[model samples]
Target: SAVISQKPSRDICQRGTSLTIQCQVDSQVTMMFWYRQQPGQSLTLIATANQGSEATYESGFVIDKFPISRPNLTFSTLTVSNMSPEDSSIYLCSVARTRGEGFSTEAFFGQGTRLTVV
Candidate 1:
């Protein structure tokens, strides 16, 4: 299993401001995924990023709002643009790690960055 860490465990921001969170993994991974947990909801996929290529975002998310960057095998960053109170949520980082014979799709999530936009 790989260990993952996230920056800024929690933060409060004003509307129209932005924040960037960083993620780091102990081991090199082929793919890194981003997710969001709203105030009272389950996790939702934001995007998936691999080194040397652009990220693939989910239906509700767009590049202009949630920009992702994976510069290497073990690190990545996500920036939330033009924040608002509605944007407050727990942002998490995930990655696929090998588990059993079949490609293990097991995901490791970061502690999560809690953002409160006011």
Candidate 2:
């Protein structure tokens, strides 16, 4: 199991400003994922970050709007660019680890960064 930590657990920002959220894992992971959970909505994957490669953004998410960096196996960051009121949401960091043979890996999530854009 991996323990994840996210910085700036909550914040209130004015519209048009950006916020950079950091994620740190206690153990090294091959793949790290970023997700967004809007108020009253289920989590939506934003991107996948692989060390030494450009992060892969999900549909409806563009690199310009949400840039991700996976500098190493245990650290990654996601920056929400050009913030808008619609961008207010909880951002989460996730990692999946193998459980056992014939069983699927379980995902571990950080507490999440709650952002509110005015």
Candidate 3:
């Protein structure tokens, strides 16, 4: 199993500020994903990080807003480039885990570090 740890469990930042979150895994993985969850809402995938290549961002997210870096298989970093009240959300780190045959894969969340931008 893969375990992930994140820092700054929660933070309250002023407007027009930025926060950088770090994600570390216990084991080497082919890919790592960054997600954001609004209060009482489903997770939204922000980007995918593959070692040795630039991170691939999903629609609606630009590299300038959420820059990602994957220097190795077990480590990655994401920086919320700009801050706004709308950016307030719970950020989560997840990795896909393989399951038994006929069963779908599952994603593991890192308890989610809540970020509040005022």
**Candidate 1 per-residue C-alpha lDDT over 12-68 given as tens digits, one digit per residue, 9 for 90 to 100:** 999999899999999999899999999889999999987999999899999999999
Model 3 weakest 10-residue run by lDDT: 102-111
Candidate 1, run of 10 with poorest lDDT:
97-106
- In angstroms, give how far residue 81 of model 3 lies from its true place: 1.3
- Per-residue lDDT tens digits for candidate 3, residues 15-85, read 88889988998888888999999888999999998999989999999999999889998888888877999
Alpha-carbon TM-score of each model against the true structure: 0.97, 0.97, 0.93
* True lDDT of residue 11, candidate 3: 92
Model 2 bad stretches (over 4 Å): none
On TM-score, the leading prediction is 2
Model 2 steric clash total? 0
Write one digit per residue (lDDT tens) for candidate 2, span 1-118: 8999999899999988899999999999999999999999999999999999999889999999999989999999999999999999999999998877877889999999999999
lDDT of 3 at 73: 89
Roughly what TM-score does model 1 have, to 2 decimal places?
0.97
Candidate 3 local distance difference test against the native = 0.88
Cα lDDT listed for each candidate: 0.94, 0.96, 0.88
